[model samples]
Structure formats: C-alpha cells, structure tokens
Target chain A: MSNNEHVKVPANLMRRFADDPEQADLEVFGRRSDGDRRGFLRGAGLATMGAMLGAAIPFNRNMPAGFVPEALAQKAMTVDGKDGLTVLNDRPVNAETPPHLLDDDVTPTARHFIRNNGIPPENTSADGWSLTVDGLVNNPMTLSIADLKSKFEVVTERLVVECGGNGRAFFDPPAKGNQWSLGAVACSEWTGVRYSDVLKAAGVKDNVIYTAHVGADSHLSGKDGKLAISRGVPIEKAMNPHNLIAFAMNGKELHPMNGAPLRLVVPGWPGSCSQKWLKRVWLRDVVHDGPKMTGKAYRVPKYPVEAGQKVPKGDFEIIQAMPVKSLITTPQTGIKMSGRSMKVGGHAWAGDGKVSKVDVSIDFGATWQSADLSDPANPYAWQRFGAGITFPMAGYYEVWARATDSEGRSQPFGIAWNPKGYLNNSMHRISVYVS
Target chain B: MMQRLLPHLFVLVLLGAILLAPGRPAWADEDELGGIPRAPGAEETYYLCSACHSFRLVAQQGLSYESWKETLVWMIEEQDMSTPEPEERELITKYLAKFYGRDRLARKLAKQQ
Candidate 1:
C-alpha cells in the first residue's frame, strides 16, 4: 500500500520541482547567485532529488543585520515535533498543527498552532506586564494580573480560535499568506475574566462600537518603526458571553508560545482577534483600522470568486466568524494498519453556531456514515466526534470528515477561490492503508 | 523523450552557468539565501522588505508584476512601511517581478498540470 506522506517543505515545492526546471529555480536551492555563495557544496542531482541538502547548513547562525536568523527556522521545525506541526515561517514563529495530531477535544497547549505577527518579547514577566483599558470610557485604568484575578470573577471555558486562512493550501490559483493545511486551529480551555466585565469597570461609552486589541509582541525591526499588528473585533463580538482576557490555558499558566501573562480569547472569531501577550484594549467609536484590518489582511471577497480572478474593487469584507470545519486527527494519513476495524475520531467546530452533524467517509466520499459527536463543553468550544469503521477489504483508503453547522451551512467540497485564501473549510481528508 | 529530459537538462545548464559565472563562490547554502532570489540588487530588496518581516515570507508568494507593485504600495500605506524613493523602488520592483512574478509561477503551474 502506498500513501502520500507530508514532507516538511511547502506543499507545492516538491511537486513543482519535480514538474519543471523553472520550478526548481523558484525553490530555495534555485535562488542562489554566484556572488553571494555560502560555504556549502552540493551535487547536481540535488534538484532532481528534490531534497534540500543545503538547508541543513547553519550559515545563518549569526545572521547579519536585516536578515532573519536561521535558529528560528530550526526551532520552528523542532519545537512541536510530536504534533507533526508544519512550519510556514520562523521569525515571529508561524506553524500549523497537522490535522491528524489535533484529534483530542481539548488541544494540548504544545499542539496548538503558533501564529505570531511579531516576535515574542524577550523576558516577558507578569511583574511588568499589565492590561490597559481606555478610550470611549469614563474611567481609564491599567490593571495588573493580580487586579484581574481579584477584581473580576475568574472563569474557565473551552473555546476554538482558528486563523481565518486555516486550510489555505486547498485554494486553487493559491493565495498569499501562509499556505496552511487543516492544522491552523485548535480548541482549548482558557481561564480568565470576561472582557465585558473589565470594560464595565471602565464604564463603556455609548458611542463605542469596537475594541482595538494590542499586544506586547514587538517587531523584529523596532517598535517605534512599525506597528506589530494591532487588530480588533466589534463591540458586539467583544461583548459575547465567552470572550475572555485569558491568563491561563489548559489549566496551566499560558505557555509563552501560547500567550503568557494575558491574551484575549475571542471565541468563535478569527484567532487574530485573540491578541496574544495582550497589553492594551482601546474602545473605539468605529472599526479599528490597524495594520491587518486594512487592505486585504484578514478581509476576504464578499462573494465567491472564480478561480484566478483578480479581487474586485470594494468587494472585500472583513472576516468575522469563521465557517464550519472539521478535522480527522486519528488514523493519521499514511499510517499502515493491520486491524479489520479501527476507532476513528476527530474534532469539529462552527463559528457563532453549533456543529450540528459530522459525517465520515471511508471510500473517499463515495459513501458516508454519521460520526457520533460529543456535546460541546461550552457554547464556543469545539466538539469531538468518533465512529468505528470496519473495512471489508481495503488496500488503501482515505477518510474524509465534513461538518454542518446549526445554521444549515456545511463545509464546501472545494474552497471558494479567494485571493488571500481566507475561510478554507473544505472537507478534511486523511489517507491510510489497511492490510 | 526530450520532454521528460528537458527539465533535467535545464538543471545542467543552470549548473554550468553557475560554474562559469564570474566571482562565483565554491559553494552555497540554503540558510544564506533564505529563499531570496540572488539576482542583482537582491541585497537591497531583501533588507528593504526585512525592515518589516522576514524575506522568506515575501519570497513565498509568487505574484504578478502588478500584484508585486500593489504589495509595495500596500506595505507603504497599510503597514506603515517606509517608502523608498522613485529610483530605488523601481530597482526593487524589477528584481521582485523578474524572479517572483506571475509568469514564473504560471510556467511552473502549467508544467505541473
């Protein structure tokens, strides 16, 4: 039995290199020029082999000014190897947890996807870190972690926070940003105070319609130089019962990678709204036009686009609640099996709605069977689904999971081709061999 | 057939070009390149973009010349990235469009299909 295994390189790199010489040129090895050569030798068969041997050389150990360090790339690959997380970028640390590894109802903090717009500040401690609530409020106050725990009723709830472009690789004509597979999402129990309670203490002004969130993570260049991605959610979303200013994840102090000290947990919205290492929450009269809010950052086309079509002018809308999506974490694709029957299970989530039903297909969507879905622990948490499958006679099979929300919206077979590849809730398929 | 062999043959031609080029170093490493195109003025282009984020992030997106121009404009306007003067912007645009542009991506995609 043969199964396509996930290689560490970008999804298209190996295939593209195999297809054309020009494709090889576009890859890491092909970008070399004579004048700027390093101290690593390679054979001519390197391109044909499609294995990046030169990538092993650690020449950027002490990268010069204005160059990204090689250590971050190495760490990105090694940091969460158990989850089979795929690295998309290193500086500012962006990686995706493979769908197969995200099988549990509550994702382990280590398995959660790491999507950072700026580098985590060195030596961030609860000592110096405090959250400031200001703008359109009668009382502006900066509160420490102790203030948050003492002043407000601390609550713990499970929630799903996913990148808007979770399954971007499925997009045809392929979009910009990280080419994330179905691993850019996770469900976790977040512990903190309700954001509304904090705002209430500050006395919300009537005209306030949005909350601009800012974090301590600074740019690799400099803070005074460029803004490190200040984004916001509408006042309505911020006022949701589940929205939190979380200080802990999975019952432990938040992992520095997950967001230490405090992070906003905006359940059922794009993870960007949940600013990690959060420090400031500014109430605003209008939508926050921060770095990512403008010019097609988290925005997508208002209507379905034909593949390869340029985005129409003024049709781009800011993505709010993500669409219904599911992933099969068990029986990871390409795992060879000897059993007649196997326990198949995974996790599913719907933004601003419940995952009403989840269906599993063993014959590549030819036939479908209902997977028993566990109830969501909270209104915003992802639900776990499981089903027993007995293969009559199987050489190779791909298990596909599709989810439908209570609103009757279901995951599409193919993602609508948006330019930025936002909201890719296509069916999550995993292949395995049953012998 | 030559169709099958053409890509392999093209690699050989590229190798020969590297071997024959002036001031060519004896070796090259992937870490040094970081996927940046080693075309003329790439250093200027790399540092210019690195002022905001990693060059690898920019290199990953294969865009059309127009899209690349628009990206620079987007960086300058939306991202608060410092704007380069007219002549410098032209040079950087040429370098980006030449290597990371749509034609190269389309060529690769056509072959893959």
Candidate 2:
C-alpha cells in the first residue's frame, strides 16, 4: 500500500494472465528488481505455519522466513503410539484427535490436520527449480529458478485452502476418495509472483476460459505413464487477485508437501485448485479432464441426491469454494465441560465468498444464536469465529455451527450423502459434556 | 445452474456393473482365505503392497510390473520392507508375475470382456 493505501497488486491483475493475445514478460517471486533473485511466495498477512510442536516435519527441514508460528503453534503433545486409535501414514501420526476442541483464531500447523496423497517430498529447493508456463499461450517458456525471481513483481495475500475431501470420513456411507478426517485444510499468507506476470510472459490468447495445472510429484502413473496430480480453475477464479502463484509461506521457503518453489493459491476454493508441488500451468481454453482433471475425483452430485444413494458420475460437478460451514474447535465432541462459563471457538469459511454471519446451536439444531466472527482482514481469508455459552445443564450437547456468506449462502444441515464424499456443507457439529 | 447431466451420467451401466464384477478380471479368489499373494520377498512385497498405498487420489497408483519392481527396490532402500517366508514368497511371485506381469493385460482384458 502506498501512503494513500491504494491497492497495490490490485485484485484484477489475475485477468492479465488470462488468454490475452498480447503476452507480457512473466516474473517469478523473490527477485528484488536490483539483481536479487526471489521465488514465488505470498508475503505478510498470516505468518507461515510450517514446523510443528512435537514431531519434526522432514523434507521441508530448511525453510525461508516470515512463517508465523501459527502453523507450528501448539502445546506439544505426542500420544502413546501403541494405542489402536491411531491412523499411521507419513509419520507415526499424520493427524490426531485434539484432547479438547480447538478455539484458537489461528490453527496451529501441528494441529492443523493431516492428509497426504503420498509421503511428503523432501530435498526440493529453489536451486535447480523452474516453473513451466505453457498451453494456449503465444510464448510457452520454462522459467529458470532465477528467471521467476528476477523478473516478476511480488505481492502477498492470505486465504484458506481446504481439500475437497475434507470432512469425508464423517459421511454416512463411505465414498471413493480419500476419507480425510477433519484436518485436511489450512490457511496461509502466500507470497509469490503474480500468475498474471507469468501469464503475461507466456502471453495468453483469446477464447480461453480455463487453465489446467499439474504437480511435480507423480505417484503410481496411470496408463501412458501419466503423473498422479490433477487440477484446474475457471479463468475468472484464477484471475481473482486472491488467486496467487505462491512461492513462500509465512515469510519462509515452502515445504515440499505444501508445494515448495511454487503452488497456486485459488482463494475460496478447495485444495484441488491450489495444486501443490506445482510444476506446470497450461493456459488452455478447454476444460481439464484427465483422470486427475475431470475423472473420478473432487466432484459432487450436481444436485441433491437421496440419502444413502451411491453417486454416479453424471450427478455431480467439480467442487469449488467450500460451503458456508464452521468447526467447533473447543469442547470437541465427547469433551467434558464443567458447570461454568466455557469459551467455545472454531473456524468458519465460505467458498469464493465472504463469511457474513455465523450461528451456533447447542441442542442439535433446536435453536440458534449468532457467534462472533473474526476479522480475517482479507476477504479470501478464513474467519476465526467464537461464542461463550454457560452449560447450566448438560448431559450431551450436540454442538454445531452454521455460516452464511456475503452472497447469502448459508450451510445446510447434513447435505445428502453422495458416493464420493464431495463438498459436505452440513452444519459443523461436535458433541461435548457438562458434569 | 440446473444442467441435466443424466445424458452424461454413467450410472445406468455402472450401477448394474459394480455388482457383477465377481467373475471379472480383478476378482478375488475365495478358496485361499489369503487368496494368492501378488509378489514375494521384501522387494516384491513393496511392489504388491505399495501399489495401492492408500485410497487417497494422490496415493492410488496403477504401476506396471517393471516399475513396480523398481519401486520395490527404492522402497526397500528408502522405506523399510518387512521380510516374509520363503514358500509364501514363491506363491506371491507366481501369482504376481502371472497376474500383474507386464504381459498380463491380454489375459486380464479377455476375462473382463
């Protein structure tokens, strides 16, 4: 912001990256114009939440700075691994059930949530790095690590990225996609070069409405040896200033799992649009539809389906912004509360839209009251909401939260179950206790 | 946007198809409770087991036999591979080399169609 506080990296800059026939020079993040090379990254806003309290985050051991400890801010606690109540993945514990519900305005990186496609990538660095900007462009170029830094103007924004499969495990009937438990989402202050800069460099053409992006890590390949990553966004969404080509988080370098060197930051969208380990950006007018693109994943039934019905391919559309929803962080379901004033907090988010109002219900939707919403500062950022309720009487309080967006879109209570547990906007609920 | 995708919905065929896969190419054998092990030894176990590492889209991989073999070696060195019995290893090798082997596409497709 200049002395006038004018919007610097204005929101519409993303439009410049669209399929414009006139291509501009693309710049990567981290270059200081005066011969210093920077990489793509989001700066300011929320501090980067890398690192954790108890365990070590391998692969991304060496990180740059500006990463606030919100991601890593947590009272360290490691459970006894012998307990069968654990799901083992990357490390002994990829995720855990917090002893108490969380109410912190910011989700600590350690307690954020754990969802992995495969083991997190290690040993990735800014050196030997290059971002490939191609497809539907006049100039397709492979930008060297330094090329991205030295050339582009850098800006920062804070937004939340939630996996489409978030909250999938709670679905009534199991679905095909990863049945991710609640913690698959995280918010970050992404700092990076503008997608517009890169798009300008690549020189977008007319008649393009969408762009497809692929990641670096390829697991078991599909037929023809296609890599395992997949994702895309409408030209409109990508052009939103909130949409970022992030190179840094919380002021430091990126971890491999989070897409070091570069990643997309599509505000109000699911993790799908923010492809990690980002390698290539294809600026095509055609919609993406490989197995990773349009096939078999990140889709929801286009309309409501009967409960317990299996989702067929045709009944759904790609999941974009999350529904108006909130999570009760404290007194997590099954928590015991004393006969006193208890502070309750959780997170509320609306996809591509602003979270306008949040209401909390203690008695399983019997009644509702407004909850305090956090000033995310940025429209695309997650709002930390809270409420204080006295448990005068308590047996089992089915606590839940509902949110409404600036567009007047509120979360529905228990959306119909689909085959692949896609966007579940059901009112966020957690059961608690009063002794 | 109320777009009628019923024309594009593959439910009619797929709903009927999912239930009838018992006799298909990927059918599980009932006689052997453990069925036939796909690969044998530490290296083979990684190939057979890690192929379906996790159900996550990022985790699902349909690896070829050759790559699977290479992956097993890497896993053993990078990721720890537990050792197994010799005879069990032989059974796994026979089954995997025959079923998941590079040339098994012909037999698998014939069974499916």
Candidate 3:
C-alpha cells in the first residue's frame, strides 16, 4: 500500500432499509469529508486519478455556470414534514409499490419504491445543481456542494434502486408509463463520489464508448413524463468499481422523493438510468442511445406477451436488469396474516444474476418449498427470504415466493404482459392468517 | 404529486377496459347523461372535479360502473373527457359523491338525483 495508497469505502451500510435521509442530490453527491480522506478511486488504478484535471470549472473559470452550493438551499415539503401518507406523493412513477411481498428486508420508507421521470423536485435545493464531468475526461469538473465534499474521496454502497418504471406499469399496451407497483423499488445506503472516484478525478480521454446519466427531473413529458428521461451507461457501467456519486440515503439526507443532493447507485441497475435529480456525467464518443437511451422509451416487444398486451409503439429495449424477485413484508393490504404458523418474508434479486433458489408457494402456483435464504452480504444485495408455513386447515392461504437465479431466471408465470409493465418475474402472491 | 397520479390512472385505464371489453353497460349513456356531477362530496368534489381532470383524476377514483365507462373512455379517448356534454355527466356524477359514489345505486341516486 505505498505510492500514495487509497482504499477506504467504509461506514453506515443498511439496517432494515437503513435510517433514511440524504436525497435531493445528497448534498450534490457529497458533504461530510474530513482528513485522512484519500478516496479518489483508492489509489488511481484507472490510471493516476485527476479527471482531466477536474475538467476545469471551479466556480466560473471564464463562465460555465450552474453549480449550486449555499447549504443546498430549500426542498423538504413532506415525506413527513406534516400529514404525510400522500402514498409517497400520490401515484404515477409506478402507481406506488405493489408487487408481491410480505417483507423483503425493509422497504417501508412509506412502502419505499417510487420511479420518478419528471415532477419530484418539490420546494427544491442543492441550490440549483451542477456536476458536468464531460466526455473522455481530462479534468472537466463543475463541482459545488462545497466542491464535491471539498474536492473528493468518499464512497458508501448498500445499493438497490430499481425503476425502469419498476415493473413498467405491468406492460402490454399498458406500457405507456408509470403505474409502478412493487413500490418502484428501494434499498438505500448510497453515500458518494466513486464513479471511479469521479472517473479518476477526471482524466480518461481515449475513444470513449458510452456514459451519460443526466437528470434534474423536469423536461416534463407526462403520460407520466413520457420516457427517455436520459440514460446511457456502458463505460463498463461507466467506469464501474461500483458506480456511486450518491451523497446519502439511509444515513439521513436524501429526500426530494429520494434523488436529492445527487444519485446514481447502479448496484443491480434499472432505476430509470439511476439518474434522479443527478446533474451530469457525459463522456459518450460513439455508443450513446439517448431517447433516454435507444430512443423514445424502455422498449420490450422483441417478443412475449399475454398478461395484458398493449406494447405497440415501436416495440422495446431500453429497460434492463430486473428479474428474479420476491416480496410479502407484512399483511397490510386489507390485513389478515397473523394466524397460520405463517412467518414468510421477502426481498430477492437476479437480473444481473445470482439468487439461486427461493420457491415457497401455498396455492396459486401450487406446491413448492425451499424458502430460508437471507444470504446477500452484497453480490448486488437484496436477499433476506424466510418461511414457516403452518395453517394446514384454517382458511386463507395464497402465499408465494419463486426466485431461482444463477441465471436460470425463474419466478415467471407473469412478466410478459408488456404494455409497459416491464420485467415482472412473477410468483409473489400473499394472503395468510387463520385462527 | 402530478395531481395524485391522475386517479390511479383512471383506475388503471378502467382496470384495463374491464379486462378487455367484456360487457358494455360501462355506465350506459345514450347520452341521457343526467345532471353530470354524478356524485360529488367534499369541497364540491374539489371544486367540481378540478373543472375536469385534476381533482387528481377526480381524487383517485374507485370506479366500477363497469370501470366507470372504461374509465370514462380512457378519459374521453386519452383524457379529454368530452361527449356526455350538456351537464357533463351531471357534473361528474354530482362530483362523484364522496369519492366515485361507491354504488348502492350510487348512494341512492346521490340523494334522490
């Protein structure tokens, strides 16, 4: 660990979805950085960190504008500022979380799962926002939020995010926009600045390939902001190593409907390009895809339909990574699960692949078993699982699980209905209780 | 929030056209279209259903007069909601009485019509 060392990714990971806060650009992707510091990609493996030389905009170096920093200015109008329960700001970015779950490792930030395309800023701040970075780098900075936590080196992960319209409004012809259930998806613990430590502090310039991200929310299209809210990743998920730029989520800070200060967790991928209030990343050169990537919307119809069908407008492709899933956290849907030995739990993931096996079922997919799971120390996280089953006779039973992964995919019986209801992975059901 | 998600998206496009057009009384209307406000309740159903389309989709509906006419024909062919004009579905079923008149014959004809 010599030649100016650097590895530190530390502290506050995720505990039952974590303590919540840090959004609205999580202080513009940063804040709270002290001394021994050193995080610019933990010793510049992507080649001597210093992103093109911070791309050069330290507060208008000859006027480049849009940077925001006066203590993130304003936005906090309600996620609980008052009579909250506006079902997390009343429907659309996927008509608020409803995709089979009795519990999946804490998603209750008011059913945690939104999906936003435009309208989310509410009240507002991070002062006005700006990040820039630019193509093939070479020090192209724009910083602010106190120059990205006083110039950089801060990373945290826990991850989860998910909203290629989280279940895309259960697709079909229905695939026009945000009716998202399964709560658009959420998991927390973001903390920022390691988009390869801002692409090695900004110095990559060579033939590029692809890397966009954008987002400030309003280009306002409506049909729930009509798709293409900006996306393009593929500079190896944009310089990978676990793409962060996050700012904060379960450590208290992110709140503009969860994309404040800055966002782009990337972990398992699919939350509308994971952009959210995030400002810019740029770097394209030749493989862009920009109508929010690949043009117009998160396409799908290369084939497979029959649950609802309306996927027609040019057929699909943009949406990605979201498959083997699970839910059932408590019994609040009209309530009734506290009787049959019934324990059941939730949270599973797979698209980028790895889950392995989940199973469950009680009736609506017929008999199966497996359950117990909980693994995830982070293989992209989200595992939990559980089981108990015991009502044998009493009454209501439905319960379900499914999972499978390691790339065999499983959890199907339902994702093909593509109006916009993207990648379902089915088998969730939920019904319990029996005295 | 975008007007509380436009009435659960006109109740999921009137629950996907009552699961793809099955019956058809979908709130029958040879345009006898009674007084219009159909059943309104609070603040005159948010001051007459946001003058049409933003009582956040008439306060996120709970419709089923056959998915409220395919959710009012997907809000009059994609949210324009015209046609039964003259009293405008009797002022949106009398401002959909306390939330889409939860039928009991729309709360006894929303108080004797």
The TM-score, computed over Cα atoms with residue i paired to residue i, of candidate 3 is 0.30
- What is the DockQ of the complex in model 3? 0.01
Instruction: Name the weakest run of 10 consecutive residues (lDDT summed) in model 3 chain A.
Output: A8-17
TM-score of 1: 0.79
Q: Taking the tens digit of each residue's C-alpha lDDT, what string does model 1 give over A211-314?
A: 89888887655647466788999988888879999998899888787778899999888899999899889999998988788777899888877888888658
The residue-level lDDT of candidate 2 at A325 comes to 67
Candidate 2 chain B weakest lDDT stretch, 10 residues = B25-34
Give the per-residue lDDT of model 3 (tens digit) for A1-435.
122112111111111012222221121122111133222111111111111111211222221112222222221122442122223223223234454432545444454555554556564477656778877788888776557766777766666667655544333333333334455665656677777777777876777877887766653323444333678667766666766777666665676666777777776767666777777778868767655565335656777757544456566665556666766554443346445575667778775667877878777776788888877756566787787877677666677778888867687765567644566656657566465
Q: TM-scores of the models, in the given order?
A: 0.79, 0.63, 0.30
Q: In model 1 chain A, where is the ten-residue run with the lowest total lDDT? A: A1-10
Query: What tier of docking accuracy does candidate 2 attain?
Result: incorrect
Q: Write the per-residue lDDT of candidate 2 for residues A287-401, one digit (tens) a residue.
A: 7774356634677778778755655756668776777667766665666767756777777788877788888888778888888987776877788888887665757777778
Name the candidate that leads on lDDT. 1
